[model samples]
Target: MSAPVQVGPSSSSGGPAPLEDLEDLLADIGDRVRAERQFRGWTQAELAQRAQLGTVALSSLERGRPTLLSTLVLACTALGVDLAHVMSSDWREPERGPSMTPQQAVVLREAAAGGSLTEIGARLDMTAAEVGSTLTRVYQRLEVTHVPRAERRAAAVRMAVQHGLITPQKRTS
Candidate 1:
């Protein structure tokens, strides 16, 4: 069985919770995480160790800054908070389609870096045709047909970035 996904209490005034912006959403989830941590009498350091994250990362998350998806998931898992709630925010994609598989996400991220489909296939040990098929599905997920086939790759990347699925690879000198 899965762990219970804890959600916030609804407004006492009988109105839907107002997630006015990204900051509000982050604050809401962070507050819940803090509450859960306090209820168990665990320090942020304790939870950080449990989550296999640094105390600094935990602090950043608690401060409502942009963070890695993995960090967010780890925090939720460690804190026993719903992963959905942590990821919920106004920054969500407005035109999401069927959820992409990890493989599909890999393909999209590879393509996002300006790699040709065949080049991506070479990196993944997949054939060019296979990469093309995978991209077709990604396009469907992002609803980018209006952008033309050749241009959909860039648009899909934008959507993925907007949805926080993948971040640009950081360069190291």
Candidate 2:
């Protein structure tokens, strides 16, 4: 991982550095927001529009400049990420729940193997809508939003490694 960016104190000539820990926290949050935005293929301008904020404001927040709580919440909402998760102090291992059942694992594996919702549903003897709903719940439990194709595969790969299911390798490139 790249070294965390440092914000200097603001001086008379420029400005003193803000509180170090707070600045670092904000910077970390900003980086995560930027990454998620990029993952979703959205521009700062688009995020700003969706968040009902000026482009400059959005830019400032993305730069880790001091910003209002409401603005941060709005920006995170627009990015389809939970602000609470982003702001939480805990960055340790994510809590693991009961492993998925064999049937559910098969469903996930098929989906991860690039099977369309309809195809996976047919294979699992479920309706497309039901498959979609189950997948949504899985994503929620994983605390993931907007799973890129690669991430979907990774999730499956992780499940397999954990002995939950076996899935084919996913093509990420």
Q: State which candidate has the highest TM-score.
A: 1
Please provide, for model 1 over 1-173, each residue's C-alpha lDDT reduced to its tens digit, 9 standing for 90 to 100.
12233333233632233323445556555667778888999999999999999999888777766677445544544444455665668334446444678999998888776677788999989999999999898888878868977778888888876665666666668
lDDT of 2 by residue, 1-173 (tens): 12453233233423223333556666676787889889999999999999998999878877877889546645654443445556778635455553556666666777766677898889889999989887766555454545684576466456454543354555789
Candidate 1 regions with alpha-carbon error over 4 angstroms: 1-98, 171-173
Please list the C-alpha lDDT of all candidates, in the order they appear.
Answer: 0.70, 0.64
Clashes of each: 0, 9
**Alpha carbon lDDT of residue 101, candidate 2?**
61
Whole-model lDDT, model 2: 0.64
Q: What's the TM-score of each model vs. the native?
A: 0.45, 0.33
